[model samples]
Target: MDIYDEIEIEDFTFDPELKIFQHPCPCGDRFAITLDDLVDGEDIAVCPSCSLMVKVIFEPEDLEEFLED
Candidate 1:
């Protein structure tokens, strides 16, 4: 089973910096993301070339520090 299946996502967002490391889509596309527009179960990224959406799942603890700030 996917790790994302076990957690309850409170929010979702995209990291523009992370986009730099994203591999090109099979169609040779690239994309960027921001943190405010993320959804719980949807892809937070897009393919610059194909415009395909990508989904990212984060653990609850992963966002704890952000919530505290």
Candidate 2:
């Protein structure tokens, strides 16, 4: 399905402990994606409780920090 919205990667809150980026979804669930997912070149954050998806605007170069050494 097409993304419901576009959220700048900077808009995401990075949880150092959880190692994931999260943003509140309109559906009352959180739209989330892990660092691993970022490193793997994934830019879609999906709300676990709904079919809604958001496109994460990110640069490949900015993903270096999330990549495994």
Candidate 3:
């Protein structure tokens, strides 16, 4: 399937402790992707409880700030 939405990295909640980014999904679950994944050029976050997924719109530099957190 295609992405459910295109969300900015700024709109997502970054968990410094977990080093993951999260956003609410319409399926009552959260979309999640790890910092490592982003660093590796990954941009898709998927919701574990459903088939929906979101495309995380960001550049490599966008992850620089989160690197310290």
Give the alpha-carbon lDDT of every model. Answer: 0.42, 0.88, 0.94
What's the true lDDT of residue 65 in model 3?
Answer: 93
- lDDT per residue for candidate 3 within 1-69, as digits (tens), equals 699999999999999999999999998889999999999998999999999999999999999998976
lDDT score for residue 54 of model 2? 97
RMSD of each: 7.6, 2.1, 0.9
4-68: candidate 1 lDDT, tens digit per residue: 12222333332444422243345665443433333232435566666465554555455445444
Top candidate, metric TM-score: 3
- Model 1 / residue 67 / CA error / Å: 8.5
Model 2 global lDDT (CA atoms, 0 to 1)? 0.88
Give the local distance difference test score of model 3: 0.94
Better of 1 and 3 by lDDT: 3
Q: Give the per-residue lDDT digits (tens) of candidate 2, residues 1-69.
A: 689999998899988778899999999999999988987888899999999999999997876765543
The candidate maximizing lDDT is 3
Arrange candidates, best TM-score first: 3, 2, 1
Rate residue 68 of model 2 by lDDT: 44
The positional error of residue 25 in candidate 1, measured at the CA in angstroms, is 1.7
TM-score of every candidate relative to the true structure: 0.37, 0.85, 0.94
